[model samples]
Target: MKSVEEADYVIVGGGSAGGVLAGRLSQDPACRVALIEAGGSDRTRLCTVPGMVSIIHTTPKVKKRFDWGFYTAPQPHGAGRRIPYVRGRVVGGSSAINGMVYVRGHRQNYDDWEAEGCTGWGAADATRCYKQLEDWEGGEDAYRGAGGPIAVTRSRDLVPATQALVEAIAETCGVPVVDDYNGADQEGVGACQMNARGGRRYSSSEAFVQPALARPNFHLISGAAAARVVIEGGRAVGVELIDGDRRRIVRAAREVILCAGVIGSAHLLMLSGVGPAAHLRDHGIAAIADLPVGQNLHDHLFVPMTFLAPTARHRGTALHFLGGMVKEAMHKGDTWFSRTVFDALGFVRSSQAERGVPDIQLHCLPWSYPSPNQDRPVRPVVDKRPALTVMPTLIYPKSRGEVTLTSADPTAAPHIDPHFLEEEADRRLLIEGMKLVREIMASPRLGDIVQGELHPGPAFTSDAELAAELPNRIHTVYHPVGTCRMGVDDRAVVDPQLRVRGVDGLRVADASIMPRVIGGNTNAPSMMIGERCAELIAAAH
Candidate 1:
């Protein structure tokens, strides 16, 4: 019943970016901010527990409650298979359901952004923003953050098998054992850093928005979904929101930012009539701006290679039973995350052509099972059984996909085409990447730990055989980005400062604006964008 006209800033989508913006902007007592989220609150039992990382994305009851659960329009290279897509529909967005791994990606990823017309987003600027937002368990260094809202702790609860796996990777393979991948040396085996603290998940909403909610100027609408921008006199004046049974026209005296994430943000832009003109006309929506809103859709793709777990006598912790029970009881929720099977990770070069750059990421988990059917979420875990899985991820894929509308209805899910493994070069890199894992597994010491190869069995020795298996196991790493890339080029959707080109009083601050997807998980960089974008907006005012 409160009037939205009283607000100076109206931020659509209270996800990763909007949450931080709402929190930072309202610091000025004179400014009033409103954050609108389509989904319900993120304050749920599943979201708070760190161990729910996998459960939040896989479990039927928990996943549907917070995830968008959209599937890609069949991938041509993936046996024409339709891949399941999961985007968060809660206040914290994907951060609520994503694996809590806290990776800042390669430092060069930001440097590349600067080369690609993103003016101030070079490695130097990005590091500053990251340091400002994180409270790393590792003490403050030039690169790591300190005294920040989000708690980031390095993996300390790794199973003994996982520790040996990391050791074997360094000793047998050429890769070194790195203390921190986010540090100066990015190439090597290491424990993953997590956006966790005392075995609890810390989403962006919890990191930035929670403290700001106490301020009188900050307002949040949990179930209000933005339909379109109210453009008048060639300027964004407000947003048309569908609030349950009523339509609300919320005015923005200063600015309107869309942080609906990669898929949602691009969908909203096309709905607002600001994307490719031909596509806009096809949807019966009047074109407001002709920009590439959802054309360059790219994501990190990975292939899982499962192997038998260490033998019964080799398995020391009884399939990680003792650690799981103790942590669960102490945390008041299942602590399967603390005893998380995905403990060991590695960064390596698939080829020497990309010198000084690690193009592939290897994640080793101490468990294995087939993926859940297209309908379910909890990543398949065989109860009480121990196994090992080495996943080779193509960090920098050349193939691009797209996101478009099926209808004008705002509630309908957008059509997504990730175009996974469309490029032959991507196939070649990952095939070689998997070979790296095969080499590690073939190590004499590693041979002592495991029973036998599970998938692509030991007899499938040739590259031709393993390459043939990729189509079956390939899946999204869930790091979709670049639908609304930021740049100074003609095809750019938003400028370096994140303001939408040709649109006054409008900006985009989310994963959608990434010029090129980062080399690692997207959660950390998304929050970094949230932090720097707030500074940019504040400086302009």
Candidate 2:
């Protein structure tokens, strides 16, 4: 193996959290930090196009670069089909390739983490870190922060269908209209805030990595894949990297921070003998620690229902090109319409009688939006005809999955078991959510505009029909988390500070460290984790 020089910190995976950590940690100028990413740079035009992200989802060249095109083991609950799991292999990770919805999740979601044995990770504590990394275009408030690297702005355009969907829900269901979903109450209908600026996607790599490159102390190595962490007498020493055919070892002076996301991070831990002993032994790896590394996997599952409209008023159009120009020229600081149509967003409980905030979310698009997994080119579905799509998502899933080592080889992907709809309660809740969305669409405000149900049709009305059809219709919202869970329990992989349990000179800084998946998009929360991890690492040093 080729020996490499040591650094103050060796951060594995330069994704959202890792990018932030690299930027924040190297701020002192005296500290030498090396960020290793398995994928190449985010220099592609496809990466910056806000609307074309789905186009690159299956493109082999693009997928090879940033996406570790992983798949879950055949899920029995999913009708014995293997679900495709797309994770970022590039510098920005999933943030570079995600929908760019800038959601911080419910405040109570964080508080629940603290209550569930994850100390120092409550709403108040996590929000401080959230504020530290955000430059909210919505302006500074008690909940929002300014002057941060990541830019958070409202959508430049609202589709007409989205607006009508919101109006319909509010008028019928009596849900309030919230300007900011990240504000006091998440249970309402409104527009969605996005991580966009100047009509371009602003990923964490663009926000954090690009700015930190000017610092000489920060060394970012792309195309370097970490195979394992080298341990010396129970202390993590460094990492073994496989760059093409070459094998190299880069030592770490302080710690080996794993920000490789949920699957990547947990798989790396198990590969390094940090997982369950039996599993490690079965994989022919000697056990270093027996922490439950990959046990609590969670994700938001979304089922989309399409509806046809009677008129063309709610249809989306490419006319946004003219609107984009106008926004750039006349209303620079104000709103810029990306599409002619509007979108409505809301949150509601699967059961309103249940305590706490809503555990389900609604995103109504005023166009025939294609699924993220679709291979066909996305052409405007209702360029001249009005259409709408109601997407109901299961936010707080009770079903937990696991990530297990399939082999001792680091190059091989781990066996992921998200176990979607494993529990009957999850299925029941989704059915209820679907029913609620149908009711919203049937409301007097939106009902008059609708022609008929476009998907799952009006015939599939029963709960059993919805449940049976769910597996085929539902797709992931791309918020996978809780594999390397942080808690104060024995099964916890990391402690309150995100330091790996029973391990020194090691830590985890990503969504994986979340004890439970937050109720909304994971990007903002992951960025929060990065900011918090930076503070903890800085304090420790």
Candidate 3:
């Protein structure tokens, strides 16, 4: 074993949260900052090009370079089979591989955080943190930011099918199209905003970390996979790592922060013997603290309701030498299904009767697929025949699962169990959401473009038929959160300050600390946590 570099802040995971945290903390030239990423650089061919997103997402190279490609334990309520779960392992993390959809979730989400004992995290104060990071294309407003690091653009150059879909959703829901979902009204169909610049995907590494690299005090190390945090008399002092066959340690003088994401952070803590006492003993590890390190896992669940439309062919991009790539920014890549895959989005209430808050999120894709099988990861159906897939997701899920250690080996993947639709309420809402999407599909504006239903067609009409089909039909919306949950409770792994409970000089920042799953996509809020963590740590100095 060899002791390597030392820094004022030793940050684990050069991911979404870690990138932002390092960028903010290193602004003070006096402090030395280091960010370690297990994966390599973010400048890959597929990652850099926006239109090649599908190839990157579904290819074998994904597991090797971009994603961790974790698989879930067999879900009982699901098809009784393991589901493929993808988490980013690169510089920008999932922000590198995601759909580039920029959703801040609802104001009620952060307010709920404050109400749950996370002080100074209400929507108003959180908005201030957002303004400091966002460079919104929609211009400045009370809700939108104008001059910030991340460039957020509301999608333009929509296909005619997407326009029809949005119009149809509005007609069915009786809500007008609101240009900005991140703005005041979040309950209508509109072009989804993205973290992009001139039609290119702009990940957090590009947005934050790249700028801070100019400072001599800040440093980034790729392929430095963290093995464990060194705890000296209950204070986290450094991070031990596996660099090839050689062993190394990067000591921290001020704080050792864990931004290893929901699964990665919690898995590292357990390996360091800071998880459930009995569970740690099973892996032949001594317990540092008998805390619930991995619990309260939740995510958005959706079922792709497929439809065949002859009118969709008109909006489909034709393969041409110069006209391919679809986006106005790129001209030489493959023709994408649409300029933005998730060009149109909708928010609706399904779980509860309340009109103000939405429990369902609708992702409208202009291309279609055949009847999906349960053996593999879900991908968009690719064919010349124009089709559409409307995936209605249960934003607020009741089902809970966990991430547990398979062994003490840091290289071994953790056992992930999202337990999809385990609860009866989650199952009920899944049916309700699917039904609502069907109604929107049957509406006149969109129905005018329809050919027929390819999945759950006219034959499977009853509620019972749809309910029975859920085990094979439903899939993840790819938003996993709440593993190392934060609260003032006993089961909480981190406190409201994000400090790891029962330890000093250690804090967890990322999606893992979410007390409850927010009502929308989680990337934006995860970045917000990074901003807040930086402020809190700077205050202590």
Candidate 4:
């Protein structure tokens, strides 16, 4: 035991949720807040540039500097391949390395949560929190918020290829172009909104944590991995952390909030002896509570299809694109770098007769890779020829997986089994999304430039063909959720208020608490969850 520190509210993981909670809770002069992050600082320029995201992550070519660099266990449904699971290890967490897309998801997603035993988490509640968190550039409206901590603006400087695709989607897919996807309806083609301000990526660290650094009552502990939560008499008293060569204990006088995202929060709970009793016993650990901690794991998986679009500006090799971006940056500064390549976004139902809501999400990028396989550490070089890629992501996947301990060693990574493409409905929806993309590509605006299909070419036309090849092509969108689900049910690890079941003075706040994964990018929703957590804590205390 090296030393011990104290705080009124001790939050583990200095990511999106943790950052917001710490910043919000520390506003009270009487409260002393502490945030412990497993990773170090995110002061690098790479984290601020949207175009530099791939250079930092998503692509296997880049080294893992700010990423946890964990790999999923071999998925039988995913061609038995151990897919790379990238999560941010820096202060801002995934928001520091993500594509910077800011989507609040469909309003119905939260409404569904309320219907599913999550009281006070309805769409109305979500809207309130979102309004409080956003500083939308589009100005204040019924739904959009303004003058808040997080800056959000729709992409106005769309590249030629992206602009063409956006128009083509409306023309062919019959999906109307909506001004605001985060408003009344999310089922439409829209410009990609991002958390950027003044031509720089605005992560939660910048939006929330950075602003609170000067507060005398707030303390940030970086570069420390949490060994386990310190529980005494069924109450979370503190957390034991491994800070490099030494170990330290951080006591929480008020509460211990776990904001370590899906994988981390669940893993930490299991390690702290707060998971299924049998599973913990198998790992030679005593169980504190037998509540399900790492169940209901789900994620959005997409199969990217490439097309030969000769007119796209960002065509050619990675080096060529980098050189051009660098040259543009030298003259234009952050203007060109702030806009991420995935600028065109659309949400559409897999079948028109199914429902009014969208089941599949679409992302259009004006760039392509040599291979569609995005397996970890194996850099698939970008091609020299011009191309456009559309990734049809299944927003609401039916497959569920779990995260379990590989060993009792806290330093080891957990065994993650997302069970991608395991459900038949999931596979079928992805196929429909692919067919829809083909229809959009065949439109006049895109068809003129699209020379041909690159990956899984025109030959694979039928549903059976696409379904059979899905395992080989599918990749995660990195929007994982529902591991430590929040509900009033017995299987729920946390309650509607996010308080951990069977434990007092502790709570789990992050994507892990989502009873069901939302139907879009998760970064914004995760931040909103953080805001809600802060509000809940403030109300209780």
TM-score of each: 0.94, 0.92, 0.94, 0.96
**Pairs clashing within candidate 1:** 58-377, 58-378, 59-378
lDDT of 2 by residue, 244-295 (tens): 8987888999899999999989999998889999989998999999988899
**Model 1 lDDT per residue over 1-541, tens place:** 2345547998887777778778878889999998888888777657776654555655677778788879899777886778888888888888876788788899999999999878889999999998888888787999988898888877775666777788878876688999899887788989987787766777878887778778888888777788998888778988989977878788999988999999988999899989999998998998889998998999998877767765421222334545655667777533554523457688887773265788888887777745423333345544234677788889889999999999888889899998888899988988887788877877776767777777656766788876776776687888999899999989999999999998999999998899888888898898888888899988899
Candidate 4 global Cα RMSD: 2.1
Q: How well does candidate 3 score on lDDT at residue 409?
A: 92
Angstrom error of the Cα, residue 60, model 4: value is: 6.4
Candidate ordering by TM-score (highest first): 4, 3, 1, 2
Instruction: Give the TM-score (vs. native) of candidate 4.
Output: 0.96
On TM-score, the candidate that comes out on top is: 4
Write one digit per residue (lDDT tens) for candidate 4, span 370-445: 4546454366556556778889899988899999999989989999999888898888888888898898888888
Candidate 3, RMSD to the unseen true structure: 2.7
Better of 3 and 4 by TM-score: 4
Off by more than 4 A, model 2:
1-4, 58-61, 310-342, 371-386
Q: Per-residue lDDT of 1-541 in model 3, one digit per residue for the tens?
A: 1223999999998777888999999999998998888888887646655656666754575556788879899888887868778788888888887877788888888888899888888888788888877999889899888888888876675668778888888888777798888888678879888777654567778888888879988878778799999998999999998888887888999999999998999999999889999999999989988899888999988887778877554223336312444443353322342235676788877747354788788988776633334337454434446677788888889889999999999999999999899899889988888888888888877756777777767777898888888888777777889888888889889987889999899999999998888888888888888988999998888
> RMSD for each model, in Å, please?
2.8, 3.4, 2.7, 2.1
Give the Cα-based TM-score of candidate 2 against the true structure: 0.92
